[model samples]
Target chain A: MESKIRVLVGKPGLDGHDRGAKVVARAFRDAGMEVIYSGLHRTPEEIARMAVDEDVAVVALSILSGAHGSLVPAVIEGLRQDGADDVLVLVGGIIPKADVPALEQAGVSRVFGPGTPLETIVAYTKSHVRRR
Target chain B: MDERYLTLSGIPIKNCYRPDDTRQLDYARDLADPGNYPFTRGIHRDMYRGRRWTMRQFSGFATAQESNERYRYLLKQGQTGLSVAFDMPTIMGYDSDHPKARSEVGLLGVAIDSLADMEILFSQIPLDEVSTSMTINAPAAVLLAMYIAVGEKQGVASQRLAGTIQNDILKEYIAQNSYIFPPEPSLRIITDILSYCAKEVPRWNTISISGYHIREAGSTAVQELAFTLADGMAYVEAGIARGLAVDDFAPRLSFFFNAHNDLFEEVAKYRAARRIWARVMKEKYGAKDPRSWRLRFHTQTAGCSLTAQQPENNIVRTTVQALAAVLGGTQSLHTNSMDEAWALPGEKAVTIALRTQQILAEESGVAQAADPLGGSYLVEALTDEMERLAQEYFDKIDRLGGVVSAIEKGFFQQEIADASYHYQNRVDKDEYVVVGVNRYQMEENVEIPLLSVGQESVRQQWKRLERVRSERDGQEVRRMLEDLKECAQSDANLMPVILDAVRSFATLGEIMGTLRSVFGEYREPARF
Candidate 1:
């Protein structure tokens, strides 16, 4: 049986603004993926645990409250510690250009800033998850 | 390429609107006088002529102390009313020191974890003199309790206070995701507040049924109007189901809407909303008070419309949206800061945002009379079309067992999903032109200072929450939580219980945790 690309879309930390995250989840579903959306206020540990338990191929973290520095790294460390480093981790939201390099270095496969098209995110997830 | 090819609400453009087009619009029968029954053109006859719409700028950041300082600043700058935006942790009902609140202690908006935080939020500001609006929904009952406690501390009667609480939880299920309890229990909590505020806080506006988040979620103007009115009607049903008198609390019901980049669509939406709401209140709910029938609303410029690429252009976007809101007869308006797409708006950006409203009121001649576009051929046609479409949505929602059932079945969620998908497809295909985002892409990076909250601020908040916990009475905290849990199980209004918990220094997380045992967490259905 051909497998569907699985993506865990989550809003980690305390940010309650989930419009972008919810929109992205729908866009992924429309693009033919089994998307698991962990609703608001999920900790980094919860997200990583869900990813491993659900056996998802990619983890998309959306942070809009300017806590990317602390949150992105926490998720990365949790995935690494749990030996789930094969998961393609993606981060998006109101990320500054200057923080992209640091986020990439911390194991974020791609950092999509504001105004990124849903198609671009969809394309990236499809290509990356298939390769993995 | 004739302009006649396009109609206002997607109807074929007409050469001109003659008496035939308006034959159905009888002045005495269809269109009542301003401030009278079926208030479509304007709520009040005087409108801005009596007084300009209240300048309720939503402002908050960092700690309660910092947000309070900004509130004082805006009030001193001639702001008419106060609108508070609580931080993410506070909105989710988490104390600053909660493990979940790490790194988000005071980011996005102000942090109010308990009555202590609420007290600090209004420390120096006089509760009696200023009417404050809180943009809180899921934890609205708790926040309102805290606000009442603040007034009590100031030795002011609750009846003397006046303002609004965005207590409309239905929107949380559809557009926003800040909900705490499941739908049935959430409605009970909302109805409880409606019943309580009608008696205790007599002047308070119980629920501001909001389309703001719906628009922010990328819904069209018509969808925003449709979904919002559906949510409002659902609340009315909840109140009536609880055996409350329609005239008793309906007079204080209010609304909050979003003014997006689509100028004419937004104006048409506001007018259609009022007409639809008035009819629903009178015919459907049997409301007697004219005030109960009128749809008084507050408007905020679309935060999602602003872009980080060319930050300065957001000012122009906000100006146009604000103008549409004023022309559409908004009771209050909040202009989005240019830098909001990046972080919490900086001082200069907030000043610029406030000035945009000032320019509209002072220089732009849009607010000289009530509903300036009342008789426009395009606008009137658009209004009629929107009203028809919105009524269709209401009918469908009613068939789906109202907003609560629709939410559980993901009906509203699916509609917003489809609309958001359509919008993204348009953007990707270049069918829609977003100035700096799609049409005006530049090779060189734009130089603008992005506002960033530092890590130190979060650490400070953690310490503050700890100090409050250590200094307060622990035994009393446990007792209040017990009371709250018992009240959650019983038919008692949760407001007084929440107030007791907050006064006893119970953390937001604890109060919410106690209730979660009874309400249980909401589990959203899978989308396929």
Candidate 2:
């Protein structure tokens, strides 16, 4: 069998609201992924380093505190600088529809908001993750 | 050929309830008369008729002047008290200009950096007349000190000021995660606040031990009651450990809870909270004062219950939750705006939210009685069961060596995560229903005029901070910060020194930064 999809769920910036992060992390685990959690208040450099160190195939970012406008792009930049550019990036939590296109253009594979079912996220990850 | 009924918390419900369900309920011991011991009915004799619950809408966004306008407008629209929601940067103890606060200044709440901002925020509003509640934690002592300094500026002494600081740090570690220092230093700061407020800010509620975030983080109603009471008991113990008398600070310790969609379960949870706290204070802690036994709490309709889709349905959800709060006998309430799930509520949405409370108070007559659902068999039975269910958690937490130890062990975090995931899984499978998200089919082109926050406040707040930094007596600011750090290093209460720093125009970031250097920052180990 193929190795389980390795994913790192990150909470960047000063946003401590992690209900989405924890719940989605649990969902990822239940879907048989090897999950790594970036605890609250992680900086972009720290998250990218963890993604590289853990050799995770995917990095999911959760930000509810409205700092996603700045934090998300910083993490993407950090990953590129570290030569982990091919790692799939996903975003969730309180991103307005207007901001989606920019995040997508910046290398985020998908963006989920409030009320998304866990199965949808799991299914999407399984189908899209580039396993190492 | 069977149908299953369940509450939002996943408690199985009977098809019909009967008097036999509560046959053993003793009116005297279990369900005492209002204002009596074990106040399961209500804390006051005539709830809302004698003095109605305070309508304190939580509002703040952008800079001081703009937020002041919103506060004045809410007051003019008949809001009885003020609840300030500080921005995440302010909430995390950073100046608006701090690089870490980029793109987030004045996003969700108002940015207050110094006594100058506090003065402008509360300008033209009398401190003595209007009681204010600040939803601030982590650096609560500094903010409270600034408020006291503002009162002094207004000729209102610290003694005359009345309000609450959500100085509850334990909940921040468990759920909110805006915590700065680790558990030990945080509890020490809380103890200092309790002791300081007991003497200086007498009318001020020192700590609002909160369960609102716990519920919002997806715990069941029973877990909310259990964990909250656990945190409250931990505070009371901390005060006692500090050699302060129980009654000295216990009476002022208040609670804040979430009014979720489970009407009967939520009511039962509140009712159970009162009974449990009363007994714990009287019997376990040896608190002699009746005020110490009486549980006073404020309820806010659950923000998590509201949906981004079909936002209008949130009005109905909030109304149901508000009715539950009123029936459950809350001391005050804040009805959530229908548009909150999408953004900070627009003026029209917040007004309707406030009006929802007014209509209930005026037209619905739900507030006429102390405990409207006090006699229902289902409610009584559920109230009894809630206590029992909560007892299960109390035992587990006690075995884990109290709230702090459990938090260190990630007990509460894991439990809440499991509960939240369970709930979402149910909704995913159509086992449970959330109105707009799952049950109702609708193609929503939502155009609710959102309260759009802009970058202007960031510029405004940065300029104000710059001016304050330059104009203040830098020598005195440095001296006060040194004194505050020295005080934080000792066992002496930090509040008095914090007040001195605030008077010297020491910014919140400066004060918190000083303490952070001494106490160190808390980093929770992340796990699934």
Candidate 3:
């Protein structure tokens, strides 16, 4: 049997709005995937290091403070520097439609907004997780 | 035919109700006249007939000058009170120029670095004439000092300053995650503010013990009530432990609650809240003053309930929520704007939000009587059920050695996380129907313009900080921060030193940084 798919859920920057992050952590767990939450107020470097150290297949970030334009790119770059760029990067929060194409161009696999069904996220992760 | 069933709190409902539901209620014991003891019916005898609840719209964004213009416009639009929302950096006690604050400046709320910014934020708006509520925690003393300094600049005395500082730090550790200091030092700062404001800013509410964030973080209504009241009990215990008299500072204590979707259940939550608070303040703490016993609160409609899918439908959701708040007898109310689920509200959206309260006050006759649903069978039974559930939580919290220990053990966080997951699972399964999201689907994307702040606002904020730094007396600022640091290390009241630091033009970052160094920072456990 294949080992459980490990995923790291992170809350970047000083954004304390973690309702989505916590719920997604539980949803991923309920989906039978192992999840590691980076807790709150984590820097981009801390999150990237955790994703690399844990050898996770997915690095999902939740940002609601509208700092996604800067923070998400920084996390992606940190992963590149650590030679962990193959990790699937999933973003969630109050991301604007106009910013989506740019985030996708910057190596984000998907950006989920509020009210997106949890099954949608789970199924997307299952189908889209980068194979080792 | 529609399938009907349970309340938002998972309370199973019956098809019909009768007088038998509330047959055990004693009007004299459970509820008296509106203004009488226990205050279950309502706090005021006449309720809105005597005076309408203040329509407070919580808003702040861009630079100080820009936010000031918004406040002036809101006042002109007949908004009864001012509620300030600070930026994420300001909320986290960082200067605008800090590396952590780079992308966050003025993105959500007004950015304040020092007294200079506060002066501009409240410019031309006299501090004494209108009441203001600052939704600030952790660094509440530093921000309150800025408000006092602004009041002084306007020639308003501290005695005449009337407002509430969101000084409830326990909730910060439990829910909001904006806490700067450890729990012990944080409580010390709150206790000092309680005694200090009791003497100086007598009309000012010292701490707005808040359940608003708790509910917004996705706890059930009962958990919101129980944890908030449990936190309130902890503060009272802290005050007494500090040797302050209960009646002296308890009267100024206030509460903040969230108005959610379940109208009847929300109303019952408020009624139960008031009765539980009155009994605890009078019976448990042995307070003689009736004012100390009364539970006064401000309510904001639940932000989590607003959907980002169909923005227009939020208007109706807000209407139901605003009506519930009024019917539940909230002292002041904030109805969330339609665009809030995506970003900070724009001018047009906030205007509609403020107008929601005005129409409810002027057009709706629900406010004509005090507690119109006081004797209803369903409402009364719900109120009792709410009270019973809250007691169970309180007992559980006490068994765990109170709220502080529960927090240290991450008990509250785990409970809230579990509940939040349950809510999400329900929504995902379509067992819970959020119109426009799960049920009444909308295919076309919304075209309403949202308020988005670019880097220009951050540059504007940085320029103000540069001027504030270049102009102020650096030596005096250092001296005041040193005094604050010393006070933090010792048992002295930190408020006077904080006020002096604000007077000396010490920035919020400097004061909070000084305290952060002395009291240390908090890092949450990485438990999911």
Please give the DockQ score of every candidate, comma-separated. Answer: 0.61, 0.72, 0.80
Give fnat of each prediction, in order.
0.70, 0.70, 0.80
Candidate 1 structure quality by residue, lDDT tens digits, B1-528? 553354222335566666566656766555566665677788999888888998889988887888889999998888889999888777877677767776777777887877777888999888888989999988888888889988999998889888899988889888787887898898999999999988899999999999999878767778889999988888898899999999988989899999987677788889888898999899999998888889999999999889888888999999999999999999999999988887778778888889888888998888887888877777777778888899899889889987888889989877876777677767778766789899987766666676666667667677777888899999999999988888989998888888888878788878877888889877665332
Which scores better on DockQ, 2 or 3? Answer: 3
Cα lDDT, model 1, residue B182: 90
* Model 2 CA lDDT for position B521: 95
The alpha-carbon interface RMSD of model 2 comes to 1.3
Q: What does candidate 3's lDDT look like per residue over B1-528, in tens digits?
A: 233577887777677779999888899999999988799988888888888898899989878888899999999999889999999899999999998888888887889999999999999999989999998999899899999999999999999999999999999878889998889999999999999999999999999999999998989999999999999989999999999999999999999999999999999999999999999999999999999889999999999999899988898899999999999999999999998887888889988988889888888888899998899888999899999999999999889888989898888888888788888878878888999999989687777788888778789889889888889999998888888888899999999999999988888888899999999998775445
Q: Candidate 1 vs candidate 2: which has greater TM-score?
A: 2
Q: List, residue by residue over A30-75, the lDDT tens digit for candidate 1.
A: 8888999987778999998898888889999999888888899999
TM-score, every prediction: 0.95, 0.98, 0.99
What ordering of candidates by lDDT runs from best to worst?
2, 3, 1
Give the per-residue lDDT of model 2 (tens digit) for B228-302.
Answer: 999999999999999999999999999999999989999999999999999999999999999999999999999
CAPRI verdict on model 3? medium
Across A17-66, the per-residue lDDT of candidate 2 in tens digits comes to 88889889888988888899988888898999999999899999998776
Q: lDDT for model 2, on a 0 to 1 scale?
A: 0.91
Q: lDDT for each of the candidates?
A: 0.84, 0.91, 0.91
Q: Model 2, B430: alpha-carbon shift in Å?
A: 0.5
TM-score of chain B of 2: 0.99
Best by lDDT: 2
